[model samples]
Target chain A: MRHTLRETWTGLRRNLTMTIAVIVTMWVSLSLFGAALLANQQVDLVKGKWYDKIEVSVFLCVPNVEGGQCTSGDGATQAQKDNIRKVLEANPQVQEVYYESKHEAYEEYQRVYRDSPVKDVLTESTIQDSFRVKLSDPQQYLGVVEQAKSLPGVQAVLDLHPVLDPLFMWLNALKWGTLGMSVLLLVAAALQIGNTIRMAAFSRRRELGIMRLVGASNAYILTPFLLESLVAGLIGGLLASGTLALGVYFIIIRKAATSITTIMWIGWHQAFLAMAAVLVVSILLSVLPAFAATRRYLKV
Target chain B: MITFDNVTKIYEGQAKPALRGVNVDIDKGEFVFLVGQSGSGKSTFIRLILREYRPTKGIIYVAGKDLSTLHSWKVPALRRQIGTVFQDFRLLPGKTVYENVAFALQVIGRPTREIKKVVPETLDLVGLSGKGKRMPDELSGGEQQRVAVARAFVNRPKILIADEPTGNLDPATSVGIMKLLDRINRTGTTVIMATHDSTIVDQMRRRVIELDAGAVVRDQREGVYGTA
Candidate 1:
């Protein structure tokens, strides 16, 4: 064991440049891999938090409403609003219906658009009353929407899917894009590791030949090379884990979590999982290539 | 002991065989010389005994184990009982003479205590006791070859195969190496050497096997370098 370790150190030191190249490549690729995993987790969290709260807003006609639905030109009466609510409640797809008054709508608009100039242009009378209908299955919103749109006082029905689809699509693209890039880099790292092992084996061919002549087993001859790659991979994995922890702490926890409280961000627990995955992937990347390269280059 | 029964070897992508069908038997503690021109199958014969190459036909038995039926994993175990030396005196350039010799025992998993005792003794036996700390580059060609010899004999293998061990040395230096092998063979270790050094072969008067075009042309009990 001592001889093997000593030989491993000798090999690493002799091929110091190649060893560093392997480690750096592994570190960057493994970090990207961990980031891709965390991005996927973040996308799932955003989807879970927002999908549960999606509701269809059925806006009733207001005074002097223009365009298509509000042709009556006068505000919807209480009886007209009650008739729309009844229709929505009768739909099996609609889980619950709540009437939002014009005053409540105006207050929500003010709260949401507090820093926008549009908030100053809207008043309580200008806001339309609406029935916020929650569906048993959010994917079945179209059925409830068509029923509410044909109701007596309904001006228009809005299904939040249109607003949320693009956001989810962008999130998904970011996740998959990160994952694709990580896979490419992982391949690059593996190739670099293979090249490094080949060079090390070439430089030590004399020692390997002598060892073989002395009756060294294949495993005995190969242990030092394997150990060299293992050490580099372990260091790269540790660095990647550190990078992942720092990224999660700074980008998600400190920045996104603090700014966007509505969505749950991945915590250290999930980061740890991603970090563990990075370590396993990095080790596999280094060790497998080294094994293959040695088998080809080191005949013993 | 070694036996070759109808052994023939043809390398891949080659039309001609390196060794033709031939049979020979060597008893224990024998010192035999294999003499042939280049490509006459001297190296091939030694490689077969080391299990480095499998015969394309027939069988070779070394130390009572059949080379054709030997498992690939068991080749190393078979090699541990045999020591090999090359024409180039294959020694680790960076290691001292002592470390180079110790490496042989170390790879075979010999205990450090035994290695400590055996390495110096073997170095002394090969006339390199006080020069253990010298590197290969610092030594003469003959001294480097002696270091190679010490490493090959450190494990005290049952058989020693030297493929032109003195191919790079002066006649005087070659004589010193021959004396060392002679001393080793007297201790009951079989020594088989393949060489083109006619002077050394003539001086030794040992069993000689001569090959021509991968076929054994002559076998003599006590022979000179050529027919006389």
Candidate 2:
């Protein structure tokens, strides 16, 4: 064991430049991998926050609007409005149905268009009463919209999917792009580790030959090379973890979370999970390639 | 003791065999010399004993164990009982003479107390007692070869194989290495050496096995280098 340690130290020091190159490559690649994982988690968090609040707006018939369900034509009566509410409440997919009176809708319009010239043209008389329906599963919004469209005095059912789909598509693209880049770099890091092992084995060919002649077992001859790569991988893993922590603290928590207060951001728990993944990947990347390279070079 | 029974070795991609249907035996406590020109299979004979190459045709027995049937994992155990020295003094360049000698014992998992005791004794036997602190580069070619001999014999292996141990040394230096091998053989350790130095072989007057064209041309007790 002492001999193994001494030999490993000597091998690492002998190939100091290659060892450092391996560590640096592992660090950069693992950092990117961790970042990709965090990006995926952040996208999931954003989806959860937004999807929970998604609503389908069911607009009622207005007085002068020519609509199929508005045969009475004086506007939807209280009886028709109550009937629509009962039907929505009875649907299993609907979580909650909120009734917005004409006055409430007019107030919402005035606040939303406070700076627009259209606010002067819109009034309580022009505004239509609507029911904002929240569903247990946002994916079932189409069913709710179909059911409400067939109800009495309902003019139109508007789903939020079209308004929100483009934003989610952009987020999904960013997540996968980061993940793809990380995978490519990880492959490069594994190759670099293999090169480093091959060079170290070549440099110590004399020592290895002597060991083999002296009846050193295969494990005894291979342990030092494995340990050298293991040490480099450990250093790289630690550096990647540090990079992840700093990135999450500075970019996600400190900047993005503060600026975008409505969206939920990932916490340290998720960051730690990503860091663990980085460490596992780094160790596997370094040790497996090193083993293969050493085995190839150790052949007498 | 080592015995080769009708052993034939044909290397890959080669029409000619390196060794063919050769039969020889050297009992324990005997000093044997293998003499041949390059590619006459002297090296192949040495490699077969070391278990580095298996015979394509017949079986070999070393210390009464069948080498052909020896498990691959047990090769190290087989090698541990035999020490080897090569043409090049294959010492760790960064290590001292004492560490170089101790490395053999260390690889075989000998204890520190045992290594400390055995290394100096073997170095002394090889006439390198005071030079233990010196590095391989700091020593003369003869002294470096002495270090290699010390490492080979330090583990007290039953058999010692030397392939041109004195190939690079002057005659006077070569005689010194031969005397060291003679002393090692006197300790009842089987010593097999391959060399082209006829002067030393003629002077040593030990058992000689000569090979020509992958076949044994002569095997004589106390033989001279040439046909006599």
Best by TM-score: 1
Tell me candidate 2's TM-score on chain B: 0.99
Per-residue CA lDDT of candidate 1, range A178-262, in tens? 7888888878877887888888777777877877877888898888999999999889899999999999899987898789765
> How accurate locally is residue A280 in candidate 1, as Cα lDDT from 0 to 100?
91
In candidate 1, which residue pairs get closer than 3 Å at backbone N, Cα or C atoms, i.e. clash?
none
Per-model fnat list: 0.71, 0.68
**What does candidate 2's lDDT look like per residue over A67-118, in tens digits?**
7577656777789899999999999999998888889877766654443346
Best by lDDT: 2
**Scored by CA lDDT, what does every candidate get?**
0.86, 0.86
- Alpha-carbon deviation at A50 in model 2, angstroms: 12
Runs in model 2 deviating more than 4 A are A48-143, A146-160
Instruction: Kindly give the stretch of ten consecutive residues in candidate 2 chain A with the minimal lDDT sum.
Output: A45-54
As a TM-score, model 2 comes out at 0.79
